[model samples]
Target: MIRIFKQLLMTTLSIGLLASIVGAQGQQTVEAASDSTQATIRVDKVDNLSSDFIMGADTSTMISEENSGVKYYDFDGKQSDLLTILNNNGVNYVRVRVWNNPYNEKGQGYGAGNADLINAIKIGQRATKLGMKVLIDFHYSDFWVDPGRQVPPKAWQNDTVDQKAQAIYDFTSNSLKTLRDAGVDVGMVQVGNETTTSGICGVTGNDEYKLFAKGTQAVRDVDKNILIALHFTNPDKTTTMLNYAKGMAKNKIDYDVFATSYYPYWHGSLDNLTYVLKTIANTYDKKVMVAETSYPYTLDDTDGETNVVKTTDDIKPAGYPATAQGQAHALRDVINAVANVGPKALGVFYWEPAWTTVGGTDRAANLPIWEKYGSGWASSAVIGYDPTVTTSTYGGSQWDNQALFDAKGHALQSLHTFKAVYTGVNEQLPDPMLSDDEATIASLLKNPSFEETKMSDYQLTGSIKLAQDTPKTGKNALNFYGDTDYSADASQTITLDAGTYTFSPSIQGGDTNASSDLAIYATINGQTKSVKVAPLTGWKKWLKPELTFSIAKQASVKLGIKIKSNAKSWGTTDDWILTKIANSDTDQSGSSSSQASKTSEQSASSESDTLASSMVSTKSTKNDVSSSKRDKTLPRTGEKVMIGFGLVGIVMLASVCVIYFKHQAS
Candidate 1:
């Protein structure tokens, strides 16, 4: 009877261990099937359309004195209105600046095209009639408002903080009301121009918030439909810009858009602009727009005015030459970067693209008025100006080289780039070497192979190196290692639509003695699921590990690669590719069979039990062991634990026999 009881115990333990293994495999199979079903449902609903991206230009001086004789011409040299040419080239919006009063005390115009309210109204009317949207920029000063100078309006310079706030509110309301009454379709309004000095009203801290709040309220009162924008300079100044937005939120200053000026020379590279735009759009939940941007079409000056951006220091961004083609490429890249920031990127407006060198004067038309009231601000405003020079012979526009039109008033190639619709897929920049399929793939990731010196898209942790000696394909591969458990990892966040995707990477262990275990972890919907890659045996060859999965909704997924154990060397990975699986590869009827095959592969190896144990041990070490302790009332599934239990069962059975024998002796 004791022998029979021992046999029964052994059978029960074996059956329980097999059941646990089968159960775990079944759970994985069910999850894969569910993901496939969700993907199929989502793929049927994908939509492809042109993104609602804004293509605009700031033509503040278009109707001013300096542009009095300007005329735009097409490639064929046919003369036309500047607005007509822009509209024909697919410009959908126009931005005009409004100063409090550009004229001097004696009523003589400051001669910089007289950017007053009346002229701004005329520009707005023209844009509206041409079926283009208008953005009213309120400088809220008699002259310019920039980082160096944000002087209050000449009439309000002596007012207190409270009084200034009230004046801003009244000025904003009255200006917007006048534009609306004049039948200008004011789609958006900028509250202040480069309000980075102190605040919009030249005050600090909460007082600035008060000014912004009042200005925003004034616009809303005039027309709630018009979007309100707060403008600043330098996209690379992320901390300053973000803090301003945060302060506005804390004080309940409601605005719809956050705008910035990004001249590559002053602000940084296109990549820097992209990062700033993405950060602001994600953090503030507000639409982002490049209110001002420009590039030179030629290095040669067409006028006598000293060119501000002619020096090497002023042409900072690499790869963009001071030529017509380079200008087109640079502008295209900027627009593409903004569009890639998702739907929150409304659009970009080229600053004063039509402010040409046509009617420029050798000297100020009203020198006495400029000196007395404006303090000779216009002459000094030109780039590369020498203060010691007395004569105002600053011939033509300093920004003529940066304009969309040449001196002959012919439209440059850059103007045509704006007509290309932003599809949010392949960018408009020229890449002659890329094939059709290569272009499609390249559009998915900017740095796919980790060959680029700057790893802008990836974040690395632990011991990481870019190995070149034994790469799989390219000249470089990512090597990650650490002596601590699961310390080596690389991750990147990507925005993807709901669909099936395949992640394939060429991998190899450093040597036979290295930790060969690798796993790909994908965090989606706040939960992490991991797929194991085959352990590498040697560094002689590379193995391709592929994982196919699906997402149910559009989200930013964090894809990571990690080593599972501690060793002298972890491994190397190269030619990593993650792309959406073609629909033809996924058949609804074959999904179940595919899942079954995957389950079989997972359990086919003799080391399957060891893998299970490793997973369980890692979890126990990281989390509370008591939370998932095995059920002692049932048979144990772990190999070592089960063997010990079997021995105990036999010992108990032997004790039972001994007790029976002792009773017989009695």
Candidate 2:
């Protein structure tokens, strides 16, 4: 009875201590959650003068949005002129992208503002009238050009490198002359839009430098006073993009400002951004700036078009919430980072803050207007210009949620982010969102998260396996990589009752180009719908992509991932989920909210199960006295705590046995 009482007392003490530790840990988590809202402007105007900092916005689609019947409003909620509102909020520079041609032979518009020289001049005139300097971004293509696609203008498709260079010079000189003739104050000219991947004017390699030089020459000849800028994207791959500048410097390419696109989520750390820009400024003796950057203020889809940022899981990737203040925090930090780069830094520009919905808020109502006004992402009219744009999968803005204005055009609080940073606008923002990774929903696919030791439920083909190198979550992820040209595919077929569902998976790493085609697809009833995963700049960069589909009746659906790449290309996909959302016609497990609760419970249960398993294993090892039984590598607290308790219990047992034996001997 005495020994049993002593044993029970020790056990109770151990339990109390462990419970205290756990409670303390839980309290700390809650405190951290609440403190996330205490965000302040980490860097102040100490980096540069307010007057010198260039607060700019890329209002490329403003004209199209306005023409589509968007009304502007001031902070006071009074309807006001857009330019006046921008100027009032301290925006001193405007950027407008100009394409060589955005229409077919029939003169039908290709959308994205139809920003030819005429519309660009008109937009520039508005900003210029408001005393704001303009940065003319020449895409040098007939349509939108980026790392993904850089098609040459139709008129220059047959031109050689030399011919294209001459065409560039002539086109630029004429465009600048026209802008000057229109009384627009042009402060800078971006020679190419995101030319980091390849060449301009449909050329690649060394020829790209030659074409860029001609564009720079044209800018100089037209107006030496105007700052000439070369723009690139993906500062995360600092080595690669820095090499672009080094290549230009090696080739004697004359340019003033070296600009980069900085999306907080897509790009790497801001410290890296500062380091790269600082190196370029000091090494090449050129000014640096963020040519384009923007963050979503909300995840709510204001327009009928799906938002670029669709999930709440995406909002805090950069450590900011999807609130108005969160947008401000992101923008301010980008400015602070640029300013932190020292005086050689020019400024930062918010991209397309005003590209809201056209016509009315409804998607159906906006379609005809988008078609009529060329206000959507890509109109059916662009099918003639861009072969990639199909009659379907076109129209509606993917950027409405990222706009600095709400869908109704009222300026978001983030609009003042520019002025606030310049004037040392230091204020506390709401804490960042608290997220639950253990979140899960009912799904048919086993080992859906790739958490299982083996690829049990998933069907694999060609170099497909679970990888430990890098995962978005957990210790393992589904990886696709190869040294030679290859097509790798992985799939899981599940039978489901009649229902509509959305499949979301996070994809990371790749060549940042589309030639290989990395995608997640779902096939139901002999019909397949696939969403292309963009090849990001680096492995560390991640994107949450979703694909939605519905079945009229119960059927089998094959959900999978496919990757086609040339030599030495790679990417990863993880955290698979297929959940039934609300629809007018459907049979689902439960409402989205109920499923969310269940998923939360499942996540928590999984965590609890792991904890319980560890504890049981620890308890089972109390009598494990063999030398090999002890694992010297103790990484978790429970095991260490249990070991300490075991030692104490053993010491007490030895004392009791010694006393009892001594009494018997006496």
Candidate 3:
């Protein structure tokens, strides 16, 4: 009977232990869910603003060419419509260009897309069905219209300025009416294509404004809400673009947006593009956009066509290679640049991203077509129709390498870059929590120190640990030991405006078996610059290392520490700081101070100095080491606390087993 009683007691104790464990687990689950809900709320407040921004692409040649045997494939090689692919990838806008007449008297097609009114209408209608916004780009010519060749159609060449203006109005109004009649929703329209220096229909100077005004008036007459865009090329010519805008204003051109063709290879630097966009947005109070842009995914020729964008000169703007990833990076940077201009900067449209190498014969086979129907006076000037000796060909697209679709018609990774939108609201938007100055001094880094056990915004490797011992200031420091050669310790990526910045960190070297060094490295625009900290003499003292460098443009930079290879190398780092240097300062480390001075300044600040006193109190209470009060460490203290609780639970379970066994013996 006693044995049975003891067995019952033991079973009861076991059930009780299991219940306690389950109860603890349920409590943890509830807390985790609560924390996740709070985090989601914070994220939605920032992400919801992106809904107002547009991400668009230009597939002018997609419909006609796709019907003529060209096809587009997804990453998995499944055939997909160009618009479907773009829309699926987060592109909300599709731009289709329209030409007046692209066929000869004999009806011989003008091989390059033959982007006539009907073709454009078909494309726009399809885009609308997909629920994507349509942007109709009116070329105002019989063929392609660009900065170099803005020739008027043969029918309109002989017309007077007033007559030509009427013709433009009639054509634009009629075409827009046709699209709208077909149930197409046109959100935006470009009046002219790339009228950088001269205007179309043989117009020049202020007369160009008359042409623009006529087209814009026609657009407004059709639908007053339709946004009219005045297009230009070469954003580096700031003075020229400004003058053009001024002339349009003088002529009272009723345009809603200013658009630019910003091909980095031809138009100049991304910096120049940013400056021009910002200037236009601030000066004109009009929406600005990069109407046309493209980067090469590969420099190698896929067909007989000679690739135009080959060489370092072409790909240097974003310093990305001519690979799939590089193309994505370049496109992302361009979009980000436009987003940086605030809400007035609409978005970007990648030019001919779906023009893959297909359909037409080789250069030799297409020579006769070029000579007979394409070598007319107008065709001879346009490169698309030029019948040269036969080396290069337009039969296969010269821009196939730059297309978002690969040679096999598969959509490249670069297509996905268009989906991201800038979510930052305008500074004028009221925020109760932030003062004007406080908002201006936003910290670029999320976690600048290793005080917390968890590291956010940083990628870490090679035996990284948050050590409580030997911290320079905070309660903890980032400890790294690289027994192997050239290992990355920790890195954080930061995006900054065009300026100089100083990266400073306090480091202490642990005992080393051989000569070793800790190096601070900064990578910007595909270039890496590194500086070595002092070698370890002893663990008693900490050394502060600082490196300053200038970024020629607004760019994303990777800053990190690396341990050089040796027999044995280890180090501890704390109190990391990154500060932008004043524009007037030439020295990279001009804003940095010695460790002793930093300590003295902290000590000298009185309690009445709210800002300084608050900063100190935060460092002590929150265990944050960043110099900026706005920077907060991610909470990782729970990791250690959870571990402690786990150990305690294990001991308690063992004690219950001992007590039950002792009762059984009695």
Best by TM-score: 2
Off by over 4 Å in 2: 1-50, 425-666
Candidate 1, after superposition: displacement of residue 566 in Å? 48
* Pairs clashing within candidate 1: 65-113
Per-candidate TM vs. native?
0.54, 0.64, 0.54
Model 2: worst 10 consecutive residues (lDDT sum):
625-634
RMSD of candidate 3 to the true fold? 21.3
Please provide the root mean square deviation of candidate 2 (C-alpha atoms, Å).
19.3
Candidate 1: list runs displaced more than 4 Å. Answer: 1-51, 65-67, 359-396, 421-666
Candidate 2 local Cα displacement, residue 140, angstroms? 0.6
lDDT of 3 by residue, 191-272 (tens): 9998864476568655676788789999999999999998997665555677667777777889989999877554555666
- Which prediction has more favorable lDDT, 2 or 3? 2
Residue 318 CA displacement from its true place in model 2, Å = 1.5
User: Candidates 1 and 2: which is better by TM-score?
Assistant: 2
Each prediction's whole-model lDDT (CA)? 0.64, 0.74, 0.66
Clashes of each: 1, 5, 0
Candidate 1 matches the true fold with a TM-score of: 0.54
Between candidates 1 and 3, the one scoring higher on lDDT is 3
